[model samples]
Target: AGTVNPLLLFDEIDKLAYDVHGDPAAAMLEVLDSAQNNSFTDHFLELPYDLSQCLLMTTANDADRIPGPLRDRMELIEVPSYLFDEKMEIARRHLLPRQMEKNGLKRTNLRVDDRCLMRLIEGYTREAGVRQLERVLGSVCRKAACEVVEGRQRVQLSLARITEWLGPVKYRQEPAAAEERIGAVTGLAWTPVGGETLEIEVSAMPGKGHLQLTGQLGDVMQESARAALTYVRAHAAALGVEPDCFDKIDVHIHVPEGAVPKDGPSAGIAMMTALASALSGVPVRAGLAMTGEITLRGHVLPIGGLREKLLAAVRAGITTVLLPGKNRDSLHDVPQQVLDALRITFVNEARDVLEHALAQSPVQDGGAVLPDGEAGHAAVCH
Candidate 1:
């Protein structure tokens, strides 16, 4: 620990509790800042220390929880959650064997087939890393050891027995709806744990053109919703919505799982699709999920967490996805299996996405369509 230039890791520094006595994070600025760190003074040492040669690293489940000034000083490298196959391979090659040895059992004493391993990954564990997965494997090893002590020579773990060991599937991924419905669209979202699917629902009622957004959306997401409504209103004539439709009725947009917080620009296209479908009485196409931001001028913009979002869509049995054209090159970062499973369409504007996302083409009802490859709004992700 006293070695020069030792690699120092600050584990979950973001989880530091607020103390009335002092600001630890504020003090960190001096330690991390290279310009000042050469003359750094630690209260513990009460002497000048040079941290300039030391390599420092930190981990956080949610980077947003880290203070802005402190976050700015460090380089952030996002470690994405593993795919199902990756988890399975890791279990077979590393976790399972190590767990067995730790529990005084041999590989031949406990055997788990791919089916059981797959169930363990998809059902028992939910995480961005394999810490929970290792614990689950360790539990299975201990249980197998007990059986061995009972005079059983070998233990063959079956999928049915997995329910007994791990209980029921804890975090099941729900697939998209069976059929298309008006004002309903499936959106992919990135979570603190991993990726998830959100069903955005919209309803129109007779009132004074009011827009209500629900589902614990954050400030940026709420702004995206308002922009979606504005886009729908501005393009009503082109998209076949009555120009006065907004003036005649109040519209409410809600993302299900109301208890969970949902945010980000990734829901922009989905919100616009739901709004367009509600106003035009058209249904969103089934088996399709989308994520991207949209502008009031009807342009599609890139979003963040593309790989995670696409993986979510694939898990949810989505067959098609609409992404911003700017994110097209980012597809290389996604797993090839996920890309092969989905039909991805890249769009530069709203009309292109609506044509692919809606059950029926928006231009069919005596409406015009926006030209392809137009300039769009802000982009921050992917």
Candidate 2:
């Protein structure tokens, strides 16, 4: 251990603790520092130890929980959650064989179709990782093992058999194929579990220019709604809305699934699109999804979790995705099959979002209008 370099892995570094006694994170800072670790001394050893040659690797679900100085010392590589197809491949190639062996079931005795595996993924498990999926497969294998012992020679698992083995479905997917309407737009969200679809709904009614927000939104999301409304008001003339529309109307922005608390700046463009659609009396295009932060000046800003968000969009039957121009570089992370199945457009401004999301052209003074091509341009498609 003297001169030979050793690799050390610290798993779940976010769970590191601190108390009145001492801060472990602070101690880790010194160990991780290349400049100081060369002569680092252990309290118990009372002797200097050279840690400069040591390679340190850490894993954490949320990097934000790690101390800023310690986090700054390491290069962050984000590993996104697996997509549906990737999960299926992993299950088929790895989990099914492993679980079958553990349950004492011969490979020839049981068969699970690909469609059935997909059903299990969509209905029984809702997580970012495959741990839940492995457990569910283990459960199915255990049941099949029992059936074999009870004199059933061959067992075939299908979608219908999932409920019999795993009880009622635990998760319900809101129909993505439902009809599209005005004042509602789909936004992609990234959570600790994975990417999810967020539906933002906006409605205007007669009032004294009040903006009401609901659905347990956090501060940043509320601010996003405000920025979106402000942008719309500033561009009312261009959008073909009455200049004083808000003076006699109240605007309400609501995200569905109200029980789950929602926050983040990434929903800005979605909220803006919803407001624009509602105010302009145009319906949002069906099967279209988007995610991006928006500035008061209507410029779109990049957000995180592009790959995960695009996967969520695809799962929800979305055929087109609008992304910020800055995020175009990350398109390589998405699978080529997914990219081929969808129309991905990159935009630098809110006007670009409007052009793709609106079902009909914006109306001004009772006549249809087009966005100024000179104002901004679209990024090349992926």
Candidate 3:
């Protein structure tokens, strides 16, 4: 069949069957690849057309799932998960007003405090997108509307009321509890929903020094962990680890919050740091954040999202951060106030990060729990 002037959008292209069984993705690839585009419409391996004139937009829940051949043909734009602050602003400017109108309540009658919005974003919802947040707010607005219809003169959304209305808190800020271990590093990650903290826990046990990975990690993160271990072993002296740390120790790396799978190259620095911290018996600095890729020679390679990741640190109440020195240029976009307050150290080598990033100071005896319904976690979206 001959095609029209169609702008094709391959939605959820990643989930399309790509293996064996006739390889639908492989068939679809010819349509996408510029060199082979003419063949898509050709009947007997004939005819050529200007396929470049056609525009294509592809959407996927996870880009990593796309076939490499198909992915290579496209220019990728990443829309990171909304930080709590951004989400609150989104809720305030867009969600709350619309929801209030929908619920037959004026914005004045129902006030969702900025703090309350943050609480909703942090504790109630956990997605890369605001789909759940919107739904939850919609429910709240509907309930408030019902109350107004039943003769309650006013409507209000309070943090305490949120839990009563929404039920038990869905997500906890401290997903991973502190344990007596040196090898675990809390890694901050940007997801489609928002900034999430991941704990990369490493431990040594008796075995032939095997590496075990869990928590449904992806290939890149797994590879990054391997690279981190390699760098740590190679630069043991610089990292303050005995050369044989990996030789005799069977290492197991796990990401806490097992139900929520995590994968990325950005966790490389954290993995390396966790290994170094674990092997050297040094704890990662409390309230310090870091993100970057690592090389085999102990070099700290730059990673993306300097602003999002840094702001993630800030929101976590982190006072210091160790990022790749090469990424220093990206700091110009960061706010000066945040820069001034934070000990943002740039390190070219992964080893140097430990000197400043890992804690020499004692960890605080206990963590402060946010009272019943407070928007805790130092909410910020800069």
Best by TM-score: 1
Model 2 spans > 4 angstroms off = 1-3, 19-21, 39-49, 175-178, 362-382
What's the CA RMSD for each of the models? 6.1, 6.0, 9.7
Per-residue CA lDDT of model 2 for 1-382, tens digit only, reads: 4554999789988898888988888878889999999988887789998889888899988888888998999999887788788899999999999999999999987899998998889999999889999999999999999999999989999777888889888877665646668789999998878889998998887778899999999999999999999998898767667666668788899998899999999999999989877777667888888999999999999999888788788788888899999999989888887898889999888888887788866544433354541121111000
**Candidate 1, which segments miss by more than 4 Å at Cα?**
362-382
Q: Write the candidate numbers in order of decreasing lDDT.
A: 2, 1, 3
Model 1, CA-based lDDT: 0.83
Of 2 and 3, the candidate ranking higher by lDDT: 2
The TM-score values for the models, in the order shown, are 0.89, 0.87, 0.73
Indicate the worst ten consecutive residues by lDDT in candidate 3. Answer: 373-382
Tens-digit lDDT track of model 3 for 88-185: 77887888788888777876667677777878877788776688889888988888887878888776778788888888788777633333346777
Q: Please report the TM-score between candidate 1 and the true structure.
A: 0.89
Better of 1 and 2 by TM-score: 1
lDDT of 3 at 318: 68
Q: What TM-score number comes out for model 3? A: 0.73
